[model samples]
Target: MTRGYTGEVSPGTPADVRELGTLTISKLSVGPMDNNAYLLRCRATGEQVLIDAANEAPRLLELAGDAGLAAVVTTHRHMDHWVALEEVVATTGARSLVHADDADGLPIPSESLVEGDRVRVGDCELEVIHIVGHTPGSIALVHRDDAGGTHLFTGDSLFPGGVGNTDQDPVRFASLINDVEQKIFDRLPDETWFYPGHGGDSTLGAERPALPDWRARGW
Candidate 1:
């Protein structure tokens, strides 16, 4: 039942009770880095897709529960985010989904995704938003509701208070900030929910007012 997090908490274990309208979303905080793995299951169709699949394969598998896993979507080409990628995919026989730009680094075969592409989990459609900077192919999956509510799954792009780390690369940092501002902040409403790849949750409203300060910091 703990789906959208507005603050940080030591996530206990994998759970499948978080309901998002007709869909069910579950999370498992795995790996040494505490990477978060999420399972988005369509309650109507019993089909699901996983995000990250970082580590602790058994726990992640269990999170899949009875819902059929259709695919594994990697937010980016981060080592922490996909350390258990092969393990999860092999066991589930799920297709690996990665952005086309970051596909070269993955150890397994993956079908490349791009901006504006639609990924279906059961009958729910998730739109891919390409966010470059944290990693060239980093993407955010967005679920919009008929009532105008929105949920954004941002891997390492936009975080609770700032954009993902850029290794002090000014060019990369600038690009990331630009995309987060123009593509995300400028476009999405303040009420949109943001679930980062690591750590807890935050809303666009909570983080939006501080964008200027974050940009100036050049982190």
Candidate 2:
């Protein structure tokens, strides 16, 4: 069974929960933008890693559960994505990881992360995949399960229907699309489940076939 959610969130409660084998993923949708903050836990050891401490500190702390957070990773340096970074990190005492290029934009100190780096939750490993588009240092994390499928935590750089906005420019859009197609689509298997920074989840199989359409629209 899934864990870490109270399931009765009003304005400030844990969003939702899902179980994927050894992992328990909890979400908190906060802030005026409705940004999503994710808490991923390794069930065996009760170790956790929080992705984008977007907002609602009290709610986030509640969602963090008893596993104790191992780290907090910023998907990018967008303002909307980190309102409670200081409070959350201060409360949990969890290390913060941000891409080298984007670390400067963060209000708090963080370790520099590079491509291919591994972020651990207990023994579970998540590989860093940098897809530079929405921001100079936008990134996604990939976790492979024992069943051979993968879970991709795509921040604003990717979503269900289309790529995230890139200043609404064709050039920027193309760059993001190229990076995503080459880095994520080409290398990973189609069975991957994409957990975006906002909204609902989608599978690679559900999205791959629409690449051409997305490219044509130039979003």
Judged by TM-score, which candidate is best?
A: 1
Task: Give the CA lDDT, 0 to 100, for residue 134 in model 1.
Answer: 95
Candidate 1 — which pairs collide?
none
Please provide, for model 2 over 80-147, each residue's C-alpha lDDT reduced to its tens digit, 9 standing for 90 to 100: 78888999899889999988989998989999898999999886889999888888898999998764
TM-score of 1: 0.93
User: TM-score of the candidate numbered 2?
Assistant: 0.92
Q: Which stretches of candidate 1 lie over 4 Å from their true place?
A: 1-17
Residue 110, model 2, lDDT = 97
Q: Could you tally the backbone clashes for each prediction?
A: 0, 0
lDDT of each: 0.85, 0.84
Per-candidate TM vs. native? Answer: 0.93, 0.92
